[model samples]
Target: MDLENQLKNLFPDHVSEKVSEKKDSEEKGIWLQDDPIICKYEKRKGKPITILEGYTGATEDFKKLAKELKQKLSVGGSFKDDKIIIQGDYRDKIMQILKDKGFAVKRVGG
Candidate 1:
């Protein structure tokens, strides 16, 4: 028997709550701020990198945003010093994404 069935057999009177799937209309827990997030491009070690910073929200929220951005862009990245450092120069794409998510974004450096 599966674990669920065994658990049910062990506690017939116990009730289990159904897991809820995230709905599109649900708000992401990240805090919104009036200040525009800064998106910039830089060459570090002769490789192009995109950096996003200036978020005033909780650190965990920023980390989650970084992870989401990396997944959507299909690239490697890191979150450090309150900045999201992406592997490529994706300023336009990243700005669009932040705008779609209701965050103001400012692009810096060509």
Candidate 2:
């Protein structure tokens, strides 16, 4: 017998709640801001890094966006000092991603 069938037989008086397969908004959805987020490129420790800042949304939303960007780019990054520092100068890729997500991005520092 299936596990659910056995459980029903053993606990006839018990009610089981249906599980929902909905994703959390914190990870799936973020608050989109009107102002353009700044995307800049800089050299640190002889390596290139892309920085994104000027997000007026909640910290959680920014963090979520940071996580998504890192995952999409398959690169390492960190959310520090209210900014997203992604390894390598992926300004084009990052801007495209943010724009696809309905965010305005401003390219800075070439």
Candidate 3:
């Protein structure tokens, strides 16, 4: 006779719809695109940095990807102007990670 009982009493004729578990399990909340994401290395202020771009998705999704990459690589980074700027050179690792996550990655420059 808790919340469930109270709800049933309030709406005896109401039918509760069951949520689809398969759909929820399938969606990662990120959009997958055909074009490959560009991963490039650069030097700003004489410090090496990795930049990821060309993601044709929502900003929030890109931010989430940025956060995940930083955590996985255990490095500092930021999301700016539709791009992810990660500290240090981690092109190979980043590309492998993206590929494993069903993303196509293109490495640019040395």
Q: Which number leads on TM-score?
A: 1
Candidates in order have lDDT scores of 0.91, 0.90, 0.91
| Residue 14 accuracy (lDDT) in model 3 | 87
lDDT score, candidate 2, position 67: 88
On TM-score, the stronger of 1 and 3 is: 1
Q: What would the per-residue lDDT of candidate 3 be over residues 24-65, giving only the tens digit for each residue?
A: 453478898999999999999999999999999889889988
Relative to the true structure, candidate 3 reaches a TM of: 0.76
Q: List the residue pairs that clash in candidate 2.
A: none
Clashes of each: 0, 0, 0
lDDT of 3: 0.91
When sorted by lDDT, best at the front, the candidate numbers are: 3, 1, 2
Best candidate, lDDT-wise? 3
C-alpha positional error of residue 31 in candidate 2 after TM-score superposition, expressed in Å:
1.0
- Greater lDDT among 1 and 3 belongs to 3
Residue-by-residue lDDT tens digits, candidate 1, 1-110: 89999999999999999876653433467788999999999999999999999999899889988988999999999999999999988998999988999999998988
